[model samples]
Target: MQKTEKPFVEVNNLYKVYDGFSSVLDNVSLEIARGEIACIFGPNGCGKTTLLKIIAGIDKDYQGKVLIGGKSPIEVRTGIVPQDYDMTLLPWRNTVDNITLPLEVNGYSRRVLREIVVEFLKKMGIKLPLLSPVYKLSGGQKQLTVIARTLINKPEFLVMDEPFASLDSSHFFQIADVLKRIWNLTEVSTVLVTHDLVTAVLLSDQIFLFSPKPGRIVHCEKISLPEPRSVSDPLFVETVNYLQGVFLMGGE
Candidate 1:
């Protein structure tokens, strides 16, 4: 991203501790420009979710300067998809109802909400039953419902905390395509947390590596690759293998 342009999201000297016992973050700092898709990569139990929650303003008891769109994170409207769909989506609600919750809460009329959701589902190629309760759907379908809900408002930025962690390989590819399509279509700035190196390398414009718990960023760099990235391509193979090796070597 160009330094001349204002950052879409910025984290400076961030630190977080829970129950006043142990630190979850340590002096973390980063910047993401408007419309950029960035990913935080780290091991499990590494405070990735904590960091994301802080960034999304879901958790405020932390020491940090987090800004989104020139304002504090809590002041900004962010679309968030948490890793656990079971927790985020209401089990009693149907797919359409789930996606329209935000809209309904914000006073969108019933007709307008339906139109928005129907159009969004069509655009994303999602075919789940609109009235099917969230609990009745398969894991992949439930995740897709969460994705649709996250995007329904056309939020200026998106925060995804390991959104695909529960899915199988086939669903991972499918949702990856959906996310890419959403990014291209809406130009929404996105920040994702994941432990999957290949997925991070494949989707992100820049990848931020994190340490184990007390998760400070260990490293960050842009991934330069042409669109329609081919896994068989030499550059793709080289970058993935290099990152995979670096991560395996404990991100030293």
Candidate 2:
């Protein structure tokens, strides 16, 4: 077979099994191009989140290769915003501190870290008041803060697992637009794992539908819808219905 160009992120012959119960991901493989937004969709217990964890380097016990920019996921400069925002944020630190923590840990100078964190805060519509004591903020605010934190590093690749799960419909769309703008501005390759088919359709250049049990990719659909897609548009509706049908068939 002819080889494709090197992908920004590539998973080859991956397998993940816990305690020999069963393989969560069985010989799965995928490739994502630079600056491309790829969403992985699957039913619960289908190992979608597990696959994200493997790509994020949080779970390293899996077999096979996961490459980010031709390097292992742990060795690559990448950022992750998990589905559980609480896990990504430090409860002791305020929002600003939490957002800057990654930069600080990476040894960025104080001035540069502050500037970058502040800019991301503004981009995410996160005001200073919400920056202090993360427990005081609302769910949506916390989620936005997590996103700001993830982007502060200016990473080459971003891994997001249902980053908008807590937001209301209005905030969800607003944040979605912000994420798109940020991705375009930074040219970051993004992998977003979400159960919301509409959000996945709107944000991704390609969508990978996963099989139910083994969580292997069943379909990879290229989205040709025009940018700044209106959710109400007929084309958007048709695409969503088609993907939804695929998901239903997969038992999601």
lDDT: which candidate is best?
A: 1
Estimate the overall C-alpha local distance difference test score of candidate 1.
0.88
Q: Would you estimate the TM-scores of all the predictions?
A: 0.95, 0.91
lDDT of 2 by residue, 57-108 (tens): 8888999999989988888777888888877679998777888887787787
* Candidate 1 TM-score over all chains jointly: 0.95
Residue 20 lDDT in candidate 2: 87
lDDT (CA) per prediction? 0.88, 0.84
lDDT of 1 by residue, 1-252 (tens): 337898888999999988898988999999998999999999887889998998888998888799889887787778999999999999878889899987887897887888899988998777788988889998888989998998888788799999889999888888888888888888999999998878888899999988888787888879989998777789999998888777777777
- Model 1 regions more than 4 Å off: 249-252
